[model samples]
Target: MAKVKINQPFTLLDTRVGVAERQTVQLEVAKLYTHTPMTIPIEVVNGAESGPVLMVCAAIHGDELNGVEVVRQLLSKVDAATLRGTLIAVPIVNIFGFIHKSRYLPDRRDLNRCFPGSEQGSLGARMAHMFFDLVVKKSNHSIDLHTGAIHRSNLPQIRGDLSCEMTKEMAMAFGTPVAIDARLRNGSLRSEASGLDIPVITYEAGEALRFDALAIAAGLQGVENVMRHLKMLRGRRRKQVHDAVIAAATSWVRADVDGIVRAQVTLGERVSKGQILAYIDSPLGQSEEAIIAPRSGIVIGQQMLPLVNEGDAVFHIAYFAHANSIVEQQLETFIDDIGPIS
Candidate 1:
């Protein structure tokens, strides 16, 4: 087990504070190979009374930069002195990956797939174990931020097991328009946290290594919505009620031919069966194959690269025919709230 020592006069719970004092919690979680300390940086803004502990994390996948920026902006504006309980922000957990601009550990392990990790395992596993123990296990709620994989772009969306009441409540509280009732994959953070009964949600948006302004805005608003739901911050009742539909299923539409792809639809566009989505054309445009949607639904994700292989995934659409009305209304509000992309 990892050793821990809490500073005295600093109670872990029911911490009381006034408007003049903002409490900050700092600690060293471990030491890196470079002999430098790996600081598990935490800022606690305890309110005068009791409330919930919400953790906002970023960069589990080091290539995802929008979440990192969102956390940075969140810290800048929050007046901790007037806040409640705690808001633990881990801006960069995968430090090694962040520095290398890679998605996995030096040992080639994907941290996201190594959750509830072993303390006596690889570097990634140890870090995962440490993070889950020190950060996730102690919080009332958690948000794991991410972006689309390296060559893909995602519409800002919250993915979680909506079956759990707490998870569903928080997902709705997260104001993102495209809330996907994503199933929990084994070894994923959501799965482990669910096992431990910790309510956690994952927000994915934009594309890896790039920052989209709409993604940032949607993220910020989503966090605020969660805080509002938890009573951590007081705000106006959201004008639009969250209307996330549970997608019965989802699938990626793959390319049928190899060529330069010209996409016609965007991230949030709705398409009917057989609607043209993209056209794979030869280098000289002499031969072209039109890729069409196989089913009717909204495009939650898509490939950003124009180049395509014979079976490359080009689009990910979620099927929710019954809930299209609510989904459409919520999407409009989300688009309006995020405003035009910067």
Candidate 2:
């Protein structure tokens, strides 16, 4: 560990007890179109003891406000003086999207997809580069928070590569009812981080631009569980939460015809093969088309929009050969553990 100089008060490091100061590092990443400046807020709690440095970031999409609030609530309750390891919490990364309540920047580029960004690249690429350089490159582990894009809704779930031992351990520590052993997408932050030998698990829940209480509660609890797993804090004996079942694959059930859609199965509900999951109806209420489940599985995600286009994704079902009774029990337990946000 590099010894921080005593006169360098800007960087707080206590050598005696090894507890460093929690400082907010503000960096002006970019300028907004409205002639206002945009800054990235990075709160760093570099603990006195030598331990893992975990980074928790949210709102890369700018519209995903649930994780922003999750990080906010987590910071409010956590005291830096008692922490063992370091915690870097960047509550909001996309200031542009956050201010406008949109998923992408004004340039229409998805920030999450721009990874290992180039300094002299597009706007999104530059932002990604600065983020990765300052935060992701500095952390030992990380968790990127996300939500369903716009009208889409997701049952609170943790997505990661189960093949990686550390990634799997972190996902299990997340304690979500469902864990999608999701594959990495090209140009994605996780994919780039993996290339750098840093495994990051993304927690997707609720919907963009809207704050779901259940989702927020689940996210908050998941972060605490991860911190506990890392032994960053001391105190009460925590229960060993079970690992999430790795789904072989997942697919979305699409609407047969464009119309108003009515869903029959709720999120986290188990369904049998050929189960009527929803119904698509014409605007005039003249004709109706039933949306049935193609295979028996749990409804992990769905769209919130009542209106849909033909072949629009309606439900996300993860198929598993396990009995519904066991699946339902795990779902119930996961929900119960979330408690209440307020």
Candidate 3:
């Protein structure tokens, strides 16, 4: 282990053991209806020196595993003895969804939409409230990691409200090649956190229920970059760290005809208006349809499943300042900067 310099002790989530130590603390969220206890696992790394409290959390959707790996690799890179401030990691926030290999709890509630929950709310809501009170409220800044829905893949990107100076700083530091100005949803963790003036951003990459090695690598690097920007770590500045292109306009192109589709572009590919992004062919060899881009932009997310119904979302495009060329040229360089997965 690299030597960490000792300085000061920091308190987090009510656990005050000492500085320069990594502690795994469990917060019992609620009792399972089956007479068992469910706990949210938290990893705290409080540095010896004083700095900002940055929380890196993942698995809010249960099946999203890229963030899990990111958190794991992140912890492996930190040495609390010489570190500054605290890093609170909750690698798996939705244990019920993870336990069942599902994206929701047994009650079919999406935990991400139940923030600032009430103590007497539904099972998911109660869990959300407990986490908000104990974990989120304690964070000075946060990175909420996520992946695309089932059968969908997203290019590594940071999505958040970029109008704020602090929030935009973290997004730019992520170096994802794409920074989306995402709207806040009611009852969401980001919404609740922003209400309290904490700069929280969403890092979206890969897909659910599986691990994309490149996504994991990029996520780890992005999180570290944000920490470095926050002065939580001291090291040589990362190269090409200011490559994120801000995209405030984004739209999804839906499949106009139900059929087996063959995509002409993959995630991260730029497309022009009226470009044939994909072709849909009927199984009976009767007819064909072309899924064209409604406007010029880059493909930030795409469906992996070939089978699609009419009106189903097939491609998600993000419109940058120069979506047609500037962003396109920077995309490959951005990937190379992050390097291949180890």
**Best candidate, TM-score-wise?**
3
For model 3, how many clashes? 5
lDDT of 2 by residue, 235-297 (tens): 532544665766667899998799999889988899989999988999888999999988888
TM-score of each predicted structure versus truth: 0.89, 0.92, 0.96
Worst 10 residues of 2 by lDDT: 7-16
Q: How many residue pairs clash in each candidate?
A: 0, 2, 5
lDDT of 1 at 288: 94
RMSD over all Cα atoms, model 1: 5.5
Task: At residue 191, give the lDDT of candidate 1.
Answer: 94
The predicted structure with the larger TM-score, 2 or 3, is: 3
The models' CA-based lDDT, in order, is 0.79, 0.82, 0.88
Give the worst 10-residue stretch by lDDT in candidate 1: 4-13
Q: Which residue pairs of candidate 2 clash?
A: 18-48, 19-48
TM-score, candidate number 2? 0.92
Per-residue lDDT tens digits of candidate 1, residues 217-283? 8888788788888877766545555656666778899999999999999988778889999999999
lDDT of 1 at 286: 93
- Write one digit per residue (lDDT tens) for candidate 3, span 202-261: 999999999999899889989988888888888745776655888869988999889999
- The better-scoring model by TM-score among 1 and 2 is 2
User: After best superposition, candidate 2 residue 308: deviation in angstroms?
Assistant: 0.7
